[model samples]
Target: MQGILTQITALLGVTVGAALIAKFLRQPIIVAYIFAGIVAGPLFLNLVHGEREIFHIFSQLGVILLLFMIGLSLNFNYLRRIGKVAVAGGLAQVIFTGVIGMGILRAMGFAFMPALYLAVAITFSSTIIITKLLSDKKDTDSLYGRHTVGLMLVQDLVAVLLMVFLTAQGGSMTISSSLIRLALGGLVFIVGVTLLARYILPPILRRIADSKEFLFLFAIAWCFALAYAASRFGFSIEIGAVAAGLALGSSTYQPEISARITPLRDFFLIIFFVILGAEMSLAAASTVFLPSVILSLFILIGNPLILYVVYRLMKFSRRNSLMIGLTAAQVSEFGFVLLFIGRELGYVGESEIASFTMVALATIFVSSYLITHNGKIAGAVQNFLAKFSEENHPQREEKPPVYDAWVIGYHRIGWNIVQVLKEKKRSFAVIDFDPTVIEHLTKEGVPAYFLDVSDVGLLSELPLDRARLVISTIPDIQDQVTLLKHVRLHSAHTVIVANAPEAKFMRTLYEAGADYVMTPHLLGGKWIGHMISDGKASRAAFRKLKKEQQEEIRSGMPVQEL
Candidate 1:
C-alpha cells in the first residue's frame, strides 16, 4: 500500500510536469500524458514499476467511464436512421482491414491464426482519443461530430459482437448454438440496461444526488457492480459499465452525476493511457514494425475514404463529407482493448499487440493535429479534391422548381416564420438533416427532407432558383458561408438568411452576402422588448403563447418550446 501510494505520487508529478510543458507548447495534453508515461515507466526511470497492477485497475475504470459517457449520450433515433450505413461501413472496415492485415502477415511468412489475430487488432480506431480530440475541438455539436459519434457506436457494437464470437469459439458449443446464445445474451443485456436506465436507476440517483460524496461513491459502486456482473455473464466489463451509466441516464440527476464523476474519470483515464504507454515495449518490434506502419497508413487514410464514399453516395455535401471523413482517421480504443483481450486468450501475440498499439498512438497523434487544423487542411486540399465532385459525379439539384421560399432548420424562429409564410400564402418547404424532424414535418403535410444543407449533392439537387428566400437556423458560420456562396452562384435573386451566435460574426456573414443574419440572443431580446412594449408579457398572454406551443407540438409541428 505504501509503495503504491509513493508510485502514484511520482506518476502524478511526472504527468503534471509533462502537462505543463505541453501547455507551454500549445499542444494537446494527451501528448504530455504519454510522454510522462514513457518517462516514468520501467523502460525509463522505473518510478511506476511495482504499482502497474493498481494502475491497470484504474485504467480499466477509465475505459468503463469513457464508454458509459458515450452510452449516456447516444441518440437512439438517429442511430436507427443511419443503422444500415453505420453497420455496413463499420463491419466492412473491420473485415477489410483485418483481412488485409492478416494477408500481409501471411505473405511475410507468418502463420494464419496469429496473423488473423494481428489483423483484428488493427481494425478499430481509438474511441478515447477520437472523442477527447473532438471535445477539445468543440465539434461535438456539429453534424460531422454527431455522425462520427454514431459511426464509433456502430464500431463499438461490432467489436462487442466480435468479442462474443471469440469467447464462444473458445467454448465447446457448436457454432450455430454459440451464435444463438450470444445474440440472446446481447439482447437480454441491452434490454436490461435500457430498463434500468428508464426506470430503476432514476430513483436511486434522485435520492443520492444531494450528496456529492455519496454520488461519487455510488457512481463507482454502480460501475464496478455492473462490470462484475457482465464479466460473470461472459460480457466485457467495458460494455457492462457503459450499460450501467446508460441505465442511469433516465434520471434527472444524470447531469449532476456526470459532473461529479468527470474529474474521477479524467484522473483514472490518465492512468489508463499512461499504462498503455508503459506496455508499449515489445521484443518482436523488429519484425512487426513494417507491417504496423503499413496498416496504420491504411487506417489513417483508407477508413476516411470509405466514409467519404458512403456519404457521397448518400447525397451529402462534399464539405461535410470531407470534414466527417477526417474525423475517422485513426484506430479506436476498442482496437487496443480487443487486442489486449485476444492476447490474453492466447489468440494474439504480445508483439502484434505492441505493433498495433504503436500504430494507434501514432495515427491518433496525427489525427489530433488534422482535426485541430481541419479548416486549414480542408482549404488547402479543396481545389485538388474538387475533381472528386466533378463531371463524373452526379450533379447536385441546385434549383427547386416549385417552392418559392425554403426554410432549413424548423426550430423556434423557423416554425414561427413558417406560420407567417403560410398566412401570407407563400410556397415553402423545410429541409432538415434530422430524420425525426423531417418525419414530423411530413406528418404536418409540410414538404420536408432528411437532407443536410451543407451536402454539395443535396445542394445540387435543390431548386434554389425558384426560392425567393432561404432561411437557415443552423448557427454554424462555415455552413452559413458555404450556403450563401452557393446561393449567390446559383440564384442571384434569392434572399439568404443564416444564423450566427455572435453579432460580429453575423456582420461578417452579411458582408459575405447573407441577406440577413439571425442572432438568436439578440432577436430574443428584441422580441421580448416588443412583447413588453405591446403589454403582451402579461400572465394571460404568456399562457396563450404556451397553449399555442403545446398545440403546435401536438399537431406534429416540431418547435423548441423550452
Candidate 2:
C-alpha cells in the first residue's frame, strides 16, 4: 500500500509538471503524458517499476470508461442527420487504410498477423483528440467538422467490432466457432439491453435521478454489471462497458451520466498512457525508425488522400473534401489499445509495438498543428489539391436572376426565414449544397441553386449587387467573412445578416461589415424569458401558444425538421 501510494504521488507530480510544460508549448497534453511515462519507466528513473500491474489495471479501466462515454454520445438520430457520407465515407477510409497499410507492412517483411494488427491500428483516427481540436477551433458546426465527428462515431463502432474479433481469436475455441458464438452473444446482448432501455431502465433512472448520489452510484454500478456479464459470456470488459453506455444512450439522463464519468475516465486514462510509454522500448523503436517514419508518412498523407478521393467522388466541393481529409491524418488512441491487446495476445512483439507507438506520437503531434492551422494549410495547397476533383471548376454556374433577397444555406434557421420571405411574397433565391433541399424547393417553385457560399468565385457570380438583402444562416466564421467581404465590396447598400454560434464572434462578424449578427443562445434565452414573463402572466395566451406549438408538431412542421 505504501509503495502504491508513493507511485501514485510520483505519477501525478510528473503528469502535472509535464502538462504545464506542454500547455506552455501549445502541444497536446497527450504527448506530454506519454513522454512522462517514458521518463518514469524502466528506461529512465523507473518510478513505476514496483506498481506496473496497478497502472496496467487502471489503464484497462480507462479504456473501458473512455469507450463507454463515446457510446453514450453515439445517437442514431444524429447519425441519420449527417446522412450517408459519415457511414459510407468512414467505412471506405478504414478499408482502404487497412488494406493498403497491410500491403506496406507485408512488403517490409512483417508476418501476416503482425502486419494485420498494425494495419488495423493505423486505420483509426483519435476521436477524443480531433474532437477537442475542432471544438477549440470553434468549428464543430462547420461542414467539415460535423462530418469529421460523424465519421469518428462510425469509426468507434468499427473499433468495437475489431476489438471483439481480436478477443475471439485469443480464445480457446476454434476461430470460426468462437466468432459465431461471439456474434450470437453480441446480438442477444444488444437485444436484451435495447428492451431494458426501452421498458425497464427509464423508470429506474427516473427514480435514481431524483437523488443525485444514487444517480451517480447507480450509473457506475450499471456499467460494471454489464462489464461483468460480458466477461461471463466470453466478451471483453471494454465491449461490455460500451454496450452499457449504449443502453443508456437514448435516456434523458445520458448527458448527466457522461458528464460525471468524464473526469474519472481522464484520471484513469493518464495511467493507461503512462503505462503505454513505460512499455515502449526505445532501442526497438530506433531499429524500426525508418519503417515507422514510412508508416507515419503514409498515415499523414495517405489517409487524407483516401478521404479526399472518397469525398470528391461523393460530389463534395474541393474545399470541404480537403478539410475533412486533413482531419483524418492521424492514428487514434484506439490504435494504441489495439496494439497493446495484440502484444498481450502474442500476435505482435515489443518491437512492433514500439514502432507503432512512435508513429502515433509523430502523427498525433503533427496533426494537431495541421488541424489548428487548417485554414492557412488549405489555402496554401487548394490549387494543387484541386486536381483530385472530378472537375477543376468553380462552383456551378448560376443564370442571372433578379431577386430582392438571397438566402445562403437553406436549412434550419434559413427554413424559417424562407417561410417569412414566402409570406411577404418577396422575390428571393435559395442557395444550398444539398440536392434534396434544392430539388424540394424547386418543386415547390422556390428558386433554389446548388452552390457552396464558401466558394468566393461562385458567390461573386450571384447577383448580390442587385439584392437589397442577403442573409447567411451558415455559422462558420470563414464562410461568413467571405460572404460579408464580397457583399460589402460589390453591393455597399445590401443589408447583410449573419448567424454566429457564440457571442464572441458577433462583434467580429459585425466589425467585418455585417449589418446584424444573430447569436442563437441569446435569442433562445430571450424567447424563453418572454414566455415566462409575458405569456405565463396570461394563462389563455400561454395555452394558445402551446396549442400552436403542439399543432405544428402534429402537422410535422417542427422548425428543426424544416
Model 1's number of clashes is 22
TM-score each candidate. 0.65, 0.62
- Tell me the lDDT of model 1 at 170: 71
Q: What root-mean-square deviation over C-alphas does model 1 reach?
A: 11.2
Which residue segments of model 2 deviate by more than 4 Å? 80-87, 106-117, 126-172, 230-236, 315-324, 332-351, 371-384, 390-562
Q: In candidate 1, what are the lDDT values of residues 296-361, reduced to their tens digit? A: 787778767766777777666666667767877877666766667777778777777778767876
Model 1 poorest ten-residue lDDT run: 391-400
Q: How many clashes does each candidate structure show, in the order listed?
A: 22, 1
CA displacement after TM-score superposition, residue 252 of candidate 2 (Å): 3.1
Q: How displaced is residue 376 in candidate 2, in Å? A: 5.7
Q: Which residue ranges in model 1 land beyond 4 Å of their true spot?
A: 106-109, 202-224, 248-251, 332-351, 390-562
Clash pairs (backbone) in predicted model 2: 126-332
Tens-digit lDDT track of model 2 for 414-470: 877888899899999888755466656877799886555666755654688789999
